[model samples]
Target: MHYNHYGREPVQLGVGLLNEPCASAAELGQRCAAAGLVLSRAPTTADLASVTEFLARWRAVVECVERTGRAALLNDLLAEYASAPRLTDHAGDGWHLHFRDPGVATDRQIAALVTVGTALHLTGLGMDRLGVCAADGCTRVYADTSRNGRQRFCSPACANRSAVRRHRAGRAAR
Candidate 1:
């Protein structure tokens, strides 16, 4: 479960922002908590903005993965945000490795976590596992963490919508 932090957290952050840019801090906090990341303080509005900016950078990385440039993109993010891996029991929840230093702002922490997580997810699951949704009128991005690695849309809802559209189009074509 701790190991999943390297992949799950970042993807959750990215997908949350992608789905709703105006999400409340409470919403994000809950999401993070569910990912096992307990916060020492409430996320500020600046933290929200930081997540917005991080999403832009993260989107670029997703685009890179699409273009088979993930390595270069990951390298850039690591250079920009990720620090040396260090272990700590900051929360006294037993020791865990942190990819960035302590006492950093929420946004920077998110950047570091996402970058390292993304690198691990891509390498472990295959580079093609992360991408934008295939459904029309949807710009959501996703990390393919499915056991079968066959995720195409951001959610089953989007996939069902696409399938219905395709079915309707086929009927109209005939």
Candidate 2:
């Protein structure tokens, strides 16, 4: 089956980008290549700096969920991050929708996908599904793809750590 571009892949990529940042433009290019996005324009040192700056804005949107704002907040965030839609099928992979134009700077591309993809994710799933990990000292964002929609950690390790902490507390109380 054809993978859904607007689904988990984008979300995972967003988290991956947030979790591990590239120190330089070359590193950014390497990470993007590893993440499997074909760059339409050549990325430069400025592009990497811009991308890092953009990530800060994106993280604010994630933080908004701490207040448990409605989907409107997410929509507003998306609007601030994205531009007016201009469809392009640049790769000829098929006539698919692109919220931004091709051959733009890497920072612009990252912002576009992250903002729009995040909007689709929250709206398509639910607004409460995205947030930082609940485990102590862990501030990672989670996509929450579990069947019960109860995921609160960025990984199983955090989950286990939290669970073990809870178990120890319970035993001590008993």
Candidate 3:
């Protein structure tokens, strides 16, 4: 039985979706394939637009977590994405669990994976592990899997930029 490493991969995929929304359904299929997920459907170009819009809503879940409301926001996302639990090992690997049913739509599948993965990550780590980038102009979402859990920026470059901006502001205040 392969234990799904459901924490980081889904979050990274979510980030990728947010960072570069698919311009066409084929692009969406390609992107998910690159992310190591096999799409059950061949999405049409219109589906790509829907996926982008759905991802925008998913980003809202990140945006709602402002040091507080983390639990509430995550709960909301989980509720939105997760379905009634069911047992499935139809691939004949081993008897494991599936939150949603098989043959679900592409967008729903992505959302379920992302929401459950995000919930698991935040709960397993800490409620404060997810947030927006601390960089001045970057609204990117960051899931802080750091040991210290004090991570703020989406990337080191953003962190450095934010630090420099803070230093400059301090100097100017003097």
Candidate 4:
């Protein structure tokens, strides 16, 4: 299933941030730019702190085993971090939706983007699409953008390692 840019990109960005967080505000700005977000200004220390807190909450959404609990967590985040949706051509590129008001702080903008994007992703794809890696000793997160939606590992390497481990375990048992 083909996913929209808004649905996929921000979730991936959220995953990236959760897995390997930024150490500083400059790094956060660089990472956001690398993720293709258009920044109105440089990130501040306060932005870094706020984003860290938001990502911790986002991690709850990822790790929630129950769909209802996950939805509740995300709903709370949406209430706190996101604003009423409005159409904007802020960059004059074309009309698009903005979940937060204009001229907000960088951290607030990111929170809105990732929160709304995650909601779109879950609703558009499946509630079970976001998950933690199944490979042993690896707790990384992943968004299941695959057509089959059976992805369990964060990377092919983890999958292969898991398969090999299972194979060896089976052989030893036999």
Candidate 5:
């Protein structure tokens, strides 16, 4: 269940943003860098707005995965963002894939990356891999990369809280 950039980057960006919560253009640039994304230019206000849209679309993609009949909905969303793929060693890291043509708008670039990345993630991993946290009253998303493929909570703290709640509920019922 190793995650490529396609799977790993956006998921990390989503979770990292949810955890630390920042959106200024500088903040977005920093987040992308930390996620090992190679941005050709410094982020601008427009990029911030664009990535923000990516965040919203990403949330919907997560939700779509949980619905019974909406499984194919992600493909439609990805289709809207689709671009021709090109291989590049832009960062000199190694030859890798880019989903968009060179010199596209920053926002569209992010959309392409996220859409392609998520598609790869869902396909490379299992369709059941990404899911909502099982902890009661929590709605955070998680990419279930656990070896057993049984991940439920977004974090250990949530798992512990749910456990304590269940224990107390059982005692009350008893």
Candidate 6:
């Protein structure tokens, strides 16, 4: 099951944002750039605030356990943040779909990008692909881009820790 960059990268960005929040617009801009997002300009304080609020909403979609509820939340986000999809050659990178209007504010652009990307991810993969880490005391979120789609922990370290804990508990019980 191959997933496009649109379906994968933005969800990763959302997870990154939720786990390690940005302290300033500059940091947010830097993070986006690091994630391969091209911003027209540096993010401002207002952009930072708006992105933070949007991430809070995006987190709900991630935390939703029911498939229907997750879809509904993502639909709400798509309606609120995204525009009609259109193909564009923006940046001369090649023709591709844009879920937002061109020349929007930086924050609005980020909102639209992340929202639409998440929608594509869930629909293309599975509704259960997004989740919080199952490791004890680890609250990180993850988008399961694995081929088998059975990811439960946010990382291999967390998975190992969880397995060790379970093994220890079983031994103790025995």
lDDT of 5 by residue, 1-174 (tens): 322456678766665665455659898788878887667787899888777767776777676656443356677766677676778777666777777778877767666766777777777777777777888889887877788888888899999999999999999999
- Residue-level lDDT of model 1, residues 1-174, one tens digit each, is 454456677767666666667477777677667666666566777887887887787788786645457788778888888888888888766777888877877777777777888888888888888888999988888889899998989999999999999999999999
Q: TM-score of each candidate?
A: 0.86, 0.86, 0.84, 0.95, 0.86, 0.94
Q: For each candidate, what is the lDDT?
A: 0.78, 0.72, 0.75, 0.88, 0.73, 0.88
Tens-digit lDDT string for candidate 3 (1-174): 466635577877787788666667777777777666645677776667666776787787777756456667667767877888788766666776666668987777777877888877877888777778878789787888899999999999998888899899999999
> Which whole-number lDDT from 0 to 100 does residue 173 have in model 4?
100
Alpha-carbon deviation at 2 in model 2, angstroms: 5.1
The segments of candidate 6 whose C-alpha lies over 4 angstroms from its true place after superposition are 1-5
Clashing pairs in 3: none
RMSD of 1: 2.2
The C-alpha RMSD in Å for every predicted model, in order, reads: 2.2, 2.3, 2.4, 2.3, 2.7, 2.2
Candidate closer to the true structure by lDDT (higher is better), 4 or 5:
4
Better of 2 and 4 by TM-score: 4
lDDT per residue for candidate 6 within 54-103, as digits (tens), equals: 99999999999999989899899899889988887767767777788888
| Poorly placed runs, candidate 5 (over 4 Å) | 1-4, 18-20, 66-71
lDDT, candidate 1, equals 0.78
Off by over 4 Å in 3: 1-5, 66-68, 92-94, 172-174
TM-score of candidate 6 versus the correct structure, residues matched by position: 0.94
Weakest 10 consecutive residues of candidate 5 by summed lDDT: 63-72
